[model samples]
Target: MAEKPGSQEAHLSSSDVSAGQLVQDWSVKEERRARRKIDTSVLPLLFLGLLVFQLDRMNLASALTGGFATDIQVTQDTINLGNQLMFLGIVILEIPFNMLLQKLGPRKWMSAQVFAFGLIATLQVFIRDRRGFLASRMFLGLAEAGYIPGAVYTLSTFYTRRELAKRVAILFFGMFGGNALSPILASGILKLDGERGIRGWQWLFLLEGLFTILVSITLLFLLPGSPDTPKPLLSPGLIRFSPAEQDILQKRLELEDNEKRGGAQGQPIPLKLVWKTLCHYRRWPHFVSTFAVFSTWSPLTTYTPSIIVALGFDRIAANALAAVGASVALIVVFGFAYLSDKTNRRGLSVITAHVCYLVTLIVARQVHPHVGKWSRFGLWTAVNSFAVGYHPVHNSWVQLNCRDPRERSISIAMWVMSAILGLMTGTQYFRGNDVPFYSTGLRTMIIMVSIGMVFAIIQVIVYTVHNRRVAEGKHTSSDGEEPMIYTI
Candidate 1:
């Protein structure tokens, strides 16, 4: 069963007396050890789910490298439309599935989602036409829609604000790890094209989708449900938390919320609250910045292998090489997260990531038409490496700005939806006309990222102004949940 917030909410809040008091009683060493336990038990399962989610969601590009387009006889334009429809499914169901999370709980609903999409992904191996491919992609998106944000929200409940930034970075490793792993896996699996009377792309989808279905079973039994229900489905034999550790896990977050939000935890946010947060102007900059920034990523993920192959590399080597930048991205993500936690500057970390990415794009677009193939490959690698580094920091920063638990969930949902929309928009940037170089698409991305940077700057300025008001007792947050601090 998916764990819902109920009796545990009051129980947890009653234990916290004031801001920071609940945490003070727990020794720093003791808490750290307990946190390590939670990380091992909870984070890995979450990471694994996302790894498969991203693999299933993004494998079409990898399949293209294995001759997906030739077998299906779909043009690049049709393929791009498939990707867009997939993201559209995700966008359509993002909020509705989130609403479902409240009813079904994270574990049950998320596990069901894993299985739903896994089956759809596995079935994709049979598609021989454009409509079938497009339909499968859309259904895959529907299955994957709310999983990311829902996972992030559940993660928020398990750790304190201080602990969240780094954990968020770690959790995202699953996605970035998949980005790196997908191509490598496809490169290997694709070699078995004729082993069982299957094409290379068919083997790619069949193996990867079956692997994801197996993971769905693991998710159903191992996800720990929630902080209150910290013992996972197979607890006594495999993963179990002490009562003391569970107490620390759930209460630390409760205390953090009580101090910042003046509110309780482990409850569903109302639909009106959802509407209110949607209309809240303070959070819009993050959404806009996310939209602009994430839009830069879609074409990169969908085309990097193709781009490298265009550099005259072997298709197999191209698929394997595509993982390089994504591999590098894992480190970039962790570095930004560590810096944000170390320096206490989420804004600075995110801004620096955005700046670095924009500069990298500027460099890539400047690449001479006659540059060496390997050198161009290197440039694309660097671009993909820096592509998503800002994302986790941006996610943590967004969380820091919200007023209460309910708004926190709603805001995170908004951020994920906006980012997905951005990805969907970016799929079209590198059109069929762009061909191998995609120089025009690079320029378009530069413009979009520049716009994203502007929104990021606007967010910083807004937060800076609002922080002063908060210090002066004029925090203008809505009445439902009061934002005590605005992080800049």
Candidate 2:
């Protein structure tokens, strides 16, 4: 008593009214499961790429400890000027590179740029003059310009807001891990001195850069572009999802569709749009807050080893002490990011970290010379930890406030540009003549942190008001999405 294949009774019993509908339903379920597994598997490769990128970027500072200043015959200010130029190059190129990512995709364009930067960084071994150093750094900066923002945008595509902070922290920890290990790596490489007449620092750059180049190749093979795309690493069993899971995927797809339709209708993102969005007096506070916090932090990363040397540590000891700072930074960054995600409050996390930074700096600056060296070292560690925590919260704040994809991209670019500009200005504060215990630089950091706190408070107030307006349904936009207030 079996029914025919196309019979209504058979179709209803088996839930396959038509071949097309069955195929469509199965395809949708398969895609959802694939996305969930694909997102998880790609995280390790993402972490590795970020680790390599950060290691290559930061090892230069450690390498400098091994006769770099003597070889180049430049003062600290001049060396810092080179660093400033690198930041300037990054600012100039980031946006264009991000736009290129949109066109060429993150996997292809970002990985290629990473490999190019790695090759260029390795070429630093041949440079003997300031001009050569500057050129190499400029090339390195250009190579790195799109990497971070591209990574951030790419992660956003794969993860929801609930999952973003932890993943971002994980990748960020790789950067901090690189910073922590740089000195140890440099110490080992330093032993390879006089290999073909190359110094230890030269070897550091060459080896590290080669490592990055190799990792970039791996990243090209591993990173998935979108949820719907086939992932090479995902298993077939993981390629299905329930109805609720499909709904979550639909949100991202819909957003992308809207952006494409909007762009195709000749509605390019306008300068006026950026301005109008920023015209909200509330937005100014967050912008200023970001600038101030980063301004304080920039000097630390650029000049911490030099500062430790001034504290009477030998070159090796100075590099080791810098590693301690990196370790503290790694711990604090993850801890703060976790708390922020748990509480869903970017502003509070930022304020707490900055306040800790201000206290650490003040104590470090005024500590008695008679104090034990270990005590001073502990204070320095605390300062670095607090400073490192500042950036993640600030970035989260920006991401929260800039809910629109185009605006978020532009905002991140602007924020990075501002931070780089601040670094450029702060670098001059640490002159060669002020080598040990740069009093001027310390004072400027204190002032900047205080100012940053004020702005952070302002952001909290503005965010609250904006949320209140949205709840009242008084701030609807043309697209009817609550005017896209920055909410973490």
Candidate 3:
């Protein structure tokens, strides 16, 4: 008989072994090596791709503070309308885009979307009226709709559940990083007010959009295809894992499938599956929690620069101040993500972040009328950090529990849709009439975040109850053993 795999004999030198032996004998050392290779090969591209995605989308926030509204002949209300239209496009197109992603493959489909949006963003430099602004924003939204959830699904394919949270955080850290960089970049670019007969805001759009196009072009070559299809369009061996590494990854995926759905793999996501996932008792709370959390956060993100300007800072100073919130978010997101992954308590981390956010909201509410300018600034900075920081844990919770890739895709889409809805509603709170104090908006955020905490608690209870039922044999698993417990 051949020596047992991963046994003493498995340590034989690679030169002495066949490919079959290599696959059968993948050891922990090799597993670590393969994981590191995947991380280096995959994540930086994801970070850059996501950074561009966010930069193109959120650049409008910085631009608005930099006289974009004035030059484009639009009011603050028109800018708000454009933002809503963009998000509406995203909500409408998200599901369809993800459905096509499975067929066209992530690289090809995402590359096309990125390239299209880059062109749209570049075209913003030419806008001279509300029509042009709205048209450009609407098209940009439609082009960028599914990129995020598609990227999440792609990451799911390569990483295990245990390893996913930190990776997701790292991926989304790119978004906060883009947020951190956006104002600084916009401030610098906006300095080109009349360098070539272009407005500062126009220069901001043109340069960032051009940079996006360049990255999209690079992605055609840089983004490796899926594990099943490792070749880029014209490059073979561009992202090849060793044969042993591939085998190990495939097996780990299979093991997870078996744990979740009785070894079923490649099940198509039909309408019924989607409906079931939508109604899954344990899943809905996550959506609600995320919706509420994002509702409170989105306006803060979209209008923070504007708020800083409201505090009497010059446009450049306001934009520069915006980076402080993102810097804090970057630090907090990574730290909390590491702890969530290490402890496998994704829900708890989310709850903690929410609590921190709520505290900031309360403090902001108290001080907005009574405190000095700098104190309110500090409070807003803390709110932004916690608001953005919580998202990775929320995503990880959903991803780990779904287990099925098809289900996960739909689930992520659903959550994203909810988040967009939250954003849309949140934007309504900070109307022009409420400008200086925005007391109504602050109170509403406090209420919504409080609701999010409740939803988070409900999810934890549901997961715990399900796990207990499986442990007590009140329900049966297909494998005739305890079911794989849901991630808490």
Candidate 4:
């Protein structure tokens, strides 16, 4: 086989080329494997962060029922006002905070916010009057406002539209799960009612706040900043992308561009945007529906335990009943979100949830005070389950309709603001003198729920008609590729 020198040189060159190609192939495979592994690990951490965030927010409601209000000499109106103030702060700060998050990234900003809120919450034990509690609540609200929407926006960045509903549902389930567990935690903490000169409510703040702080610190190490960011935990084998995988990533970017260009271009969301969004004929119905429904139950978080206590149940039983509401909420949220995603119909799910709420509220209103404790518990649980289930679907509807990120952020903030406004005003409806029965408040809630139902129906009609126009290619300009349709 000893040929000419030129031929031998060419043969060696071809062999070297073949070896290089094989190495490249191996590298690509390794990268793919590493990406999958990293995704698996990071997803769980994201879920954990969401869970803890929600837990911290709702724990205060349960804690307050453990005598925090009396110790601070505050009324139910004052407690709700504190919640209202917190939400007001959230309304004021959400956009700026979200923008800061976009600049600083979630890993730094979200963790810092969580840590700050925990510190403030822990310090709340020293609050001696309405003003101090109010100040603390406002700070807490400001710190926490960006967490939920930021998480939602972050999730959207990772998952496709098709995969988002389930992921969002899972994240929210963690939140409700925390809400469910808080009462149980409160039950145990209440046992230390007067231990170490610290009140039960103080222990509630201290323990939960400490736990949150610890979780935030852990997250600083565990969380992945974004999809493109690399971590040391990922194996080298998975770091490289195959030709096909690279193509897929490129296509996704192209699609994102198309979407951004097609949507209704508005000025960067400002206070005026809120008014403009409100005035959009297509959007008002959904906004009103959401306002009515959320407003009706806004007091439930702060007042449910108190309501249960007034029903002649002990503090522990009241807390337990609140847990039942959380459990029921979990079931409804999962069920409704699944169906909504499967059907690709956010409006129907919201409407169905609202109808269920209406029925439950009516039933709750009619239930006899002379009825068995079990019956009363069942009634309240049924109402709460419907209410909780309705929340996610409502939010999903809003998110789905919002094509512009800036507009979406503003819309969510406004929705939350409206809800808080209702809570602030609604608290006065449930005076302490109306305890045990709360006839006026219950009746008002029933009317509000009914009004919500009407608005939900109207939104469904509007969304359906607009979607039909989109399908027919008759309404493509205003709503991007589709007509702007809003659903509650």
Task: Return the top candidate by lDDT.
Answer: 1
TM-score of each: 0.93, 0.83, 0.91, 0.81
RMSD of each: 5.2, 6.7, 3.9, 8.7
Rank candidates by lDDT, best first: 1, 3, 2, 4
Candidate 2 residue 48 C-alpha distance from true site, Å: 2.7
Tens-place lDDT per residue, model 4, 349-380, is 87788888888888888874668777877777
True-structure Cα RMSD, model 3: 3.9
Off by more than 4 A, model 4: 1-47, 230-257, 260-281, 469-488
In order, how many clashes per candidate?
0, 4, 0, 7
Model 4: lDDT equals 0.67
Compare the candidates by TM-score and give the number of the best one.
1
Arrange candidates by TM-score, descending: 1, 3, 2, 4
lDDT of 1 by residue, 1-488 (tens): 21232222223333445543553345455557778876887788889999998898788878988888988889999988898998899899887777677566677777888888889999998999989989998898888988888888778777777788999898899999998999999889888888878898888888888989998888777777666666555434156778777776666565566634311234666889889889988779899999998998999889989988888988889989999999999999999999999998888889899999999999988983768988888899999989999999999999877766667777888899999999999999998888898989999999999898899888889988887887888876456555556778
How high a TM-score does candidate 4 get? 0.81
Instruction: Choose 2 or 3, whichever is better by TM-score.
Output: 3
lDDT of each: 0.82, 0.69, 0.79, 0.67
Residues 1-488, candidate 2: write the lDDT tens digits. 32332333311232333432221222334434645664565566667777877777777777667888788776676677787788778888977776677666666776788788789878888888888988887777788886676676666666656567777777677767777788767767877878888898899889999998998777666665544443332232223434444433544343333331111011234667656555646667777877776776666666677667767787677877888888888888888888888998888988888888888888878883557767767777777777768676677677656655666566666666666666666667666666566667777888988998998888888878877788888777765554655563
TM for candidate 1 is 0.93
